[model samples]
Target: MPQIPSAEALRHARAALATETETIAKAGGRAPVTDPVITPFVRALRAGGFTIQTSASGCDALGTCPACQNRYLYTALRAGLAHAVCPHCRDAADRKAAVAGAARASAGPCPPDRVGWRGAAIAAPPA
Candidate 1:
C-alpha cells in the first residue's frame, strides 16, 4: 500500500536530496557568513525547496540585500563567488561620482574639503 514515484520524479527527488545535502555540507564547512549579505538568501534557501524558490521567486542571487547592500549571490556566500554592488547603491555611487567630476571640472584640481572626499590615502604626485 504505498505509491511509488515515477522515474522522472524519482530522479528529481534524488537530485534535490543530493543538492540539499551538498548545500548543507558546503555551508557548514566554511567559517560561516556573518555578512548581512547572506541573511535573506540563506533563509529562503533553507525554508523553501530550491526549485520552487527558483521558479517562483527567481534565483536568490538576483536579489539585493537591504543591510550591506551587496547583490546576494548563491544560497550561501561561497569563497569563489563574486557579487556586484546592489543596484540601488550603484546608482547612488554613480550620482556621487558625477557630482564630484562636475565639481572638479569647475573648481580646478584642489578642492577645499579634499580630505572629506577621501577615505584612503592617495599616492602623491611626482617629486
Candidate 2:
C-alpha cells in the first residue's frame, strides 16, 4: 500500500485534474471518472511505469484522494475536485524516457548499404 500524499503533491494533482476535466467537458463529453479514465492523460505516469490506486469514487466529482490519488468531488453538491499524483517521480522519469527514446530512435538500425563501424554501421568500412 502507498503512503498518504503530501499537500504539495495534492496541489499538483488538483491542478492537473482540473485541466483535464475542463478539457473533457469543453469537448461536450461526459466522461465517467474511473481508474482507466486517466490512462490517456497520464502519459507522465505511464512513461514512468507507475501504478495508480484509484478509489470507488473514481466516477465522482473527479476528486483524488490524498492517500490513493483517487478522484472525487468536494461534496455531492460541489463541482470542484481534488487530486494528487503518484509519488513515483513520474515527471523526471518520463522526461528521461522521452529523451532516451528519441536518442534510440534516431540511432536506429543502419541502412542496408551500411556496415558495422562499432555499434554504428558505416559504409562497409570504406571497403
Candidate 3:
C-alpha cells in the first residue's frame, strides 16, 4: 500500500510550486505547463485520495486539512476571531474548556500554597 504523505511533505510541495509560479510570473512568462518536482506531489496527492486543482492565477493547492484530516479547513477568519482555525480542533478545545470550567466551578478556589511554587527563601545554599 502507498503511504500517505505527511502534512510537512504536502506543505513543501505546495511551497515549491508557489516559488516556481512566482519566478515565472516575475519574468513575464506564464506558469509552466508542468513542474517536474510538483508533478510527483500531485500524483501522490491524487493517489492518497485528494483532488488536484491548481489556482487560476497563482500556485495555491487547496485540498484536505493537514491537522485533523477534515476537508472543510481553510485559512480565513473564523467567527469573532482574527486568526484562522480548524473547526475540528476549535470544537475539541471548546468542549475541553467547558469540562474544565465545570470542574473548577465545583472545586471552588484552589489553595495557593499547594500550587507547587517554591520561594527563594526556601532554597538551600550551595556547599
Which regions of candidate 1 fall more than 4 Å away from where they truly are? 1-3, 29-127
lDDT of model 3 at residue 61? 22
Quote the positional error of residue 3 for candidate 3 in Å.
6.3
In model 2, residue pairs whose N, Cα or C atoms come closer than 3 Å (at least 3 residues apart or on different chains), thus clashing, are 62-72, 63-71, 63-72, 64-70, 64-71, 64-82, 65-70
> Regarding lDDT, does 2 or 3 come out ahead?
3
lDDT for model 1? 0.30
Q: Can you tell me which runs of candidate 3 are displaced by over 4 Å? A: 1-3, 33-40, 43-127
Q: For model 3, name the residue pairs that clash.
A: none
What ranges in model 2 sit over 4 Å off?
1-3, 34-127
> Candidate 2, which ten residues in sequence have the lowest lDDT sum?
73-82
The lDDT, on a scale of 0 to 1, for candidate 2 is 0.32
Candidate 3 lDDT by residue in tens digits, 32-81: 68655445455434443433222223233233445678653322211211
The per-residue C-alpha lDDT of model 2 at residue 21 equals 78
lDDT of 3 at 119: 10
Per-model lDDT: 0.30, 0.32, 0.35
What would the per-residue lDDT of candidate 1 be over residues 39-124, giving only the tens digit for each residue?
33233333322211121223332445454555532221112212222322322111121122122311234333221121221333
Best by TM-score: 3
lDDT at residue 61 of model 1 (Cα atoms): 26
* Model 2 lDDT per residue over 6-124, tens place: 33444555566678878889999985574433433343333333323222233212333455554431111001111233333211111111111211221234223321211122232
Indicate the TM-score of model 2: 0.27
* TM-score ranking, high to low: 3, 2, 1
